[model samples]
Target: MAGWMNLVNEWLVPALVLSSLAAHLVVVVLAAVRRREASGWPRAILWLANQAADLAATQTLGNLFLGSTSREKHLVAFWVSFLLIHMGRPDNISAYSMEDSVLSARSVIEAIFQIAGAIYVLIKHIIIGGGGGGDGRTFVLASITMFLVGIVKYAERIGALWLGDLGSIQSSGKKLKRASLSVGHLEISDDEQALQAAHRLLHITKGAFADYSSDEVEHKSSHANDEQARLAAARRLLHIARGTFADGNDNGSRWSWSQGWEQLFRLVEMELSLMYDVLYTKAAVIHTWHGYCIRFASLHFTAIAFWLFSLSSKDGYRWSDVYITYLLLIVTFLLEVRWLLSALASTWTYAFLINTNSGLRHAALCSGRWRRLRRFVMSLDLCRLALVRDPSSYRMWSGKIGQYNLLSECTHDMTSFYRTLAQRFGSEDSWKEYKYCYSGVLHISSPVRNILFNNIWDKLKLAYKPEEMRAMAAMPVPHDNDARRRNKLDKALRFAPELQDYILTYHLATDIFLQCSGQKGAACAFVKTIEVLSNYMLFLSVVRPYMLPGLKIHSLYTATRDALHDIW
Candidate 1:
């Protein structure tokens, strides 16, 4: 019976912990994979797998000291290192959503509990069987070093959690003060063509939005180019329509983009990078000087401690424990390597290398080759088929942009799905299968944004009021508001000098355009495209108010939402 119990302690328990540890290590590798251009389901599966492995490893470590008499000192030290390694999550991913940051308090509490558990396990091991695998003093000191490293890494995550919240950004006294200083000024960048253009336009629109002399804003821009101005204004409207309110503050909001919408594909490329930063990367601090410091410290400490453990004698320990320790050491260093590679592969790294004369930039020497490499590394096909989705998929993750459908908006929400309407309402005699569903792909070389931006810019130029033009321009302006009528109320509202009215009015006009055009020619298809995109923008404004520039739309959106809900 004593022999049997020893066998259980020597093999069974270690095997369980090994399984958990192996699962955790595999997740650390698998999580490195990015399927941004791939379908959404694969990413979701990978994320779930990583989370499960994390929980399992934590539980198994706790079980190490639970009522059992198998107190191995080396096992305790390995446990400390595992805890630290897990805390150093993939560089690209922090909280999966804004809500994750909100609930991060729970994670903080759990970390505290785990820390306490580690303390208990260490104490219990000392009382039971003594030092891990070497001289008592040496093992204790080694364990302490790894523990401190883990604690520091864990603390960084807690800080990230506290700061990553949308509410937190608004609440941070430090960040808010910095943001307040820039509200009235344009954030210019010569490196980012669209952002530079937007900066100039922001100067003019900032005045229209609030209190500023348009003359002073224009005077400051006497040296700026007009092409940047046009492209910026167009891209800004697109960002507004898409629910990406990139800037915020006391003075006003500014939108920035690296590529102009005129080239089209470049905007798509840059959009992918920006979305990744906001959604996954810790854009808040990971690229900062302090971020680099913490990463270097964590890496060096982990590698050093792992080397010490690798060199220590392993005689007195069970064979299973010895094997597991070797495995842990190998995994720790491998993860560090993977982490470094991920940091290099980030968009922030690319920007940093471009802006500086860092000797590390030889990898990206040729611009054309660099772009091709970027597309291959950065793009992923995010396909969540609208026609074949379950309700659960919608609840799993909330994107920066909510889903939209023009046909559904014509009716009540949740009462029906849009594809059903397309099928049921169609003229069956014309063709057999008429199916329309919207599944967005993130990495297509589509020029749809460029088309939309130019069209909107032209409309704004045509609709500019006399005083508005005189106020915004450095010289006399052209008068071009003589276009034919299309419901004066809608026309006036659509072309109103205010940006908000443009968002609302265009939504209404598209519906009217669709009703009048009928579903036939090339004209109909073009009108239909405008209608869907335009109405979707309005739907986004209503459903996702936070993503819009700070504005008052409760009553208007409520009425629109109520009407849509009824039809839905």
Candidate 2:
């Protein structure tokens, strides 16, 4: 019976623990690479991570409490270290779904149960004699240190889920707003009262429970240091209609450069970034000095435990058990170092880089590989979108930006035929890499964004209150010589008042100009680019109406959508 029990302990228990840890490590790698895409793979990986962590925890406790093998103390230390490193998951993602965030209370309860189990294992095995002989002193010390760190790490995740709930965010917004910052006046036509009302919204929306100091971003928002800020600014401009291509509100939109749409966009993006950090990153808990102090204490404790284990005798322990203990020690240190690097790469660190003394900032930016590191920190995009070139182009923006006819549907079949033909003839490398689209969205280069924004701004100037127009005229256009020309937006903008007219005309024009002429046309790629953008911009209008107060709602999205079947 004693020999049989040792066989089970060495083989079955070890297998269970190794399987759990191996599954967790694989899931961690997949989640890091694919979390951004809205796909089934990410969901599957998150599920595996959660399940593996639980399995590992249960196995660790089992080995600690019931083991009689001579290698018991070493296995206990190894399992505890496994739990700690597993707890230190990637910061950018916590829960896989909104429902997961809502279940945060349950998560906390489960964490409490796990903690209790771990404590029970410790008292029964180390303090008593369940671990069976040998100096268990050093093993208990190390297990305690890892348990504390793991507990705190798990607690942070549950707390982040609670914070991440959109309902909680909305509730906080309602309580906040002790004082509203003055948004400057928008002097526009009385015909465009919607535009005027939109301007009345305050930039910094504070939650009543805790004050969010959004004004801290004032200087940061002023500069276009990252792509998000630039995109947000483009959305703030009021020259486009919300839906459809028809002009409605752009005539009266006017705000000064310093305090107008630009500043508002900057503030909006920053607040969202803050909320994302609270939900996904360690900003809410670990960025604090207290968090850092505890982190270092845990590290010191782990190091001390390592030293103690080295000094202690290991006469009866199996060689494999000795190797496992050292493996856990080395892996724990590696994880801690990795966590340190992740914390340093955060946006919180970027703020310090920007404001610190000139020499440090310069060194960070101009030094060898440090510049690449700084760029990585600065360009962290929370929301990334890519255009699926083929499927993405299939839809129209509010049924206005492009038109669909029975004939045009056939044209798409032709497009498909050509694409297939091209694929067959193309090199294997090119075919393999090509998507119906590429790895990106409607927005292109900076120059394109500038032209798109300025074109709408200029058109809206026609309706601005006379005084507002005069003020804008006095200030310099944010872009340079070529952008000032109206021709810059000619191709990009659908100048037609009726979105139907624009789409139908473009379809008819392209078919007649390209297919009739027996060619894809000199401007085929350009035309396709404009068409894709029009559809995407229209989609953005309906789904994210609040983001684009200027042109987000110009077209009658439902109305146009309703008419689509009839047109087809």
Q: TM-score for all predictions? A: 0.56, 0.55
lDDT of 2 by residue, 481-562 (tens): 1123222233234433354434444544555565566664244555554444554444334333333323332355445544
Q: For candidate 2, what is the lDDT?
A: 0.47
Q: What is the per-residue lDDT of model 1 for residues 274-299, given as tens digits with 9 covering 90 to 100?
A: 43344344655665567666667767
lDDT of 1 at 342: 46
Error of 1 at 220 (Å): 30
Total colliding residue pairs, candidate 1: 16
Which candidate gets the maximum TM-score versus the true structure? 1
What's the lDDT for all of these models? 0.47, 0.47
